[model samples]
Target: MGLFTRLDRASVLYNGMADRLGVGETQRIDQPAGAAAYRSALLRCSACAEAEACAGWQMEHARADAAPGYCRNRGALAALRVE
Candidate 1:
């Protein structure tokens, strides 16, 4: 994929994972730290090798508490998830 396409795909994957984990909700409640973590997780997702798998998984599952093992940002996103 081209640069923009890759970035778009990455953003979609990151948003899907974050939404499933409630990261956006957490960031809204705790702006600074949560936003920082979310941004970091997106950056990691942008460099991940499994963006396509992540997308497929998100589409298949209505909800998920954690990202797949192949996700580089899995741990970080999990930590940011709202309880």
Candidate 2:
């Protein structure tokens, strides 16, 4: 499988958890600016106490935003689908 394909699968997992947990849209994180910021965020996020739950909400919000979304917390999760 490809890199994006892997991330997409991971994103789906988190999305499912978010649904089961009843997390809301207001919980989605903010977007990061560039590659470095995104990477830093990803590392920091990995250590978060709420990483699993937060990741779930992020995945859903990303899907709504037409993700492969970037953020200072979760990094990019998917590429925009092409026609």
TM-score of 2: 0.34
- Residue-level lDDT tens digits of model 1 in 1-83: 67677767777888777787777764633756766665666667778787768888898977887888898877777766668
Q: Please give the lDDT score at residue 80 for candidate 2.
A: 15
Which stretches of candidate 2 lie above 4 Å from their native place?
30-83
Question: In order, how many clashes per candidate?
Answer: 0, 2
lDDT, candidate 2, 33-72, per-residue tens: 5445434434544434554555556555533433222332
Question: Which RMSD does model 2 reach against the true structure?
Answer: 11.1
Which prediction has the highest TM-score against the true structure?
Answer: 1
Clashes of 1: 0
Q: Which candidate number maximizes lDDT?
A: 1
Clashes by residue pair, model 1: none
